[model samples]
Target chain A: MSKSIFYHAGCPVCISAEHDIVSLIGAENVEIVHLGDNPGSIEKAEKSGVKSVPALVTPQGNVLHINFGASMEDLK
Target chain B: MSKSIFYHAGCPVCISAEHDIVSLIGAENVEIVHLGDNPGSIEKAEKSGVKSVPALVTPQGNVLHINFGASMEDLK
Candidate 1:
């Protein structure tokens, strides 16, 4: 039930983001719910209000998602 | 047996590529293998020498992969 669940669809960005989060929270602190592999988890994520991939469900039950855009250099 | 198989891990690029390929060949002609979703298919993909996502396996057993780099304009 650690699922401080990180829901990912396995994009490179998602992969990297998961790595960073795990490093911060410690691997044992989180559960990775892959939306692609775990269809059952999809409903759980949706219940948490996840409408996209790379979602993180905090232990407190809030859903956090991301949108990758141009790199900093591109912002100029 | 339509698996002109397309192996993807659900990145935006992979998603777009899959869409384009299906448009070209027709959905009925291909089998979409999501590596994250189908753990069972990973073995098949590896046997076919798939080293990355967004891979396409032709009906004849040919594997095609890509490495996305800077856009063409970036070369200037």
Candidate 2:
């Protein structure tokens, strides 16, 4: 199963967490979508009930993970 | 005088606004600093009294502009 991570490039926390995630999971395993690149991301986020960036969606599409400023250890 | 814009990559609003600013001022005229790139950004933001991302600082260092989800028109 693949994991997709949707994030905003302009948010500090999101960017920081993304790097940590990449470090932990390796960039190859994670598919990153930069919200700023897509204007429709807001609507997608709303549909997915996303209130913040750095949201993680599992390949099965059954789990949605929201991080409210996670530590490096948590990310790892 | 140069203009420096500081922003976070994780926040949706910041990413949205940063794009607007880029579209408005042109990428060359704007010096964008992604806060996630620098761990010291938090301290810099605190010292500059920044409560949010997409903060713009003028060359003279007299004016600090903070964008709270501005429209394209406002950005232009």
Candidate 3:
């Protein structure tokens, strides 16, 4: 499986989506990063042009889950 | 049909969950309240003992969808 990064901001939605993301992307395959606690998270998100949390950074360099919940079908 | 209130905070997850909620609770049955835009939203939420958004106040006086996505099964 390709690398998938899940960035979260400790919001209720982010908290809720964490389980779904792990279930869809596989816990081992996804590097869960808490934007509020992780160092350089803001900088990284800004650099990547990510405007929101609960965002998924796919191996293809596509950022998703910025506007909606990450559907299992969409993740796969 | 009962009065079901959906409280949201304009978060991406909240934005995404809106449709799911409407589908589960029926559009006419659910009143969508944006916490940031609506007057007295904060006060109402506080009075209701709501700490977060994406919350569903059921007619039964149960508050759901505060921590997770509003599942159709759960709502029904």
How does chain A of candidate 2 score by TM-score against the true chain A? 0.64
**Candidate 1 falls in which docking quality class?**
incorrect
- lDDT by residue (B3-71, candidate 2, tens digit) is 545445445766755564454345776677666666556566556655445565444342233334332
- Candidate 1 chain B, run of 10 with poorest lDDT: B67-76
* lDDT ranking of the models: 1, 3, 2
Best candidate according to TM-score: 3
- At residue A4, give the lDDT of candidate 3: 69
Q: Assess each model's interface with DockQ, reporting 2 decimals per model.
A: 0.02, 0.02, 0.03
Q: How much does candidate 3 score in TM-score?
A: 0.43
Off by over 4 Å in 2: A62-76, B1-76
lDDT by residue (A6-68, candidate 2, tens digit) is 445446766765665454335876677666666556566556555555555444442233334
Compare candidates 2 and 3 on lDDT and give the better one.
3
Number of clashing residue pairs, candidate 1: 0
Order of candidate numbers by TM-score, starting with the best: 3, 1, 2
lDDT of 1 by residue, B1-76 (tens): 4347878777776786667556544688778977767667777787896766676677666554532322222222
lDDT for each of the candidates?
0.62, 0.50, 0.60
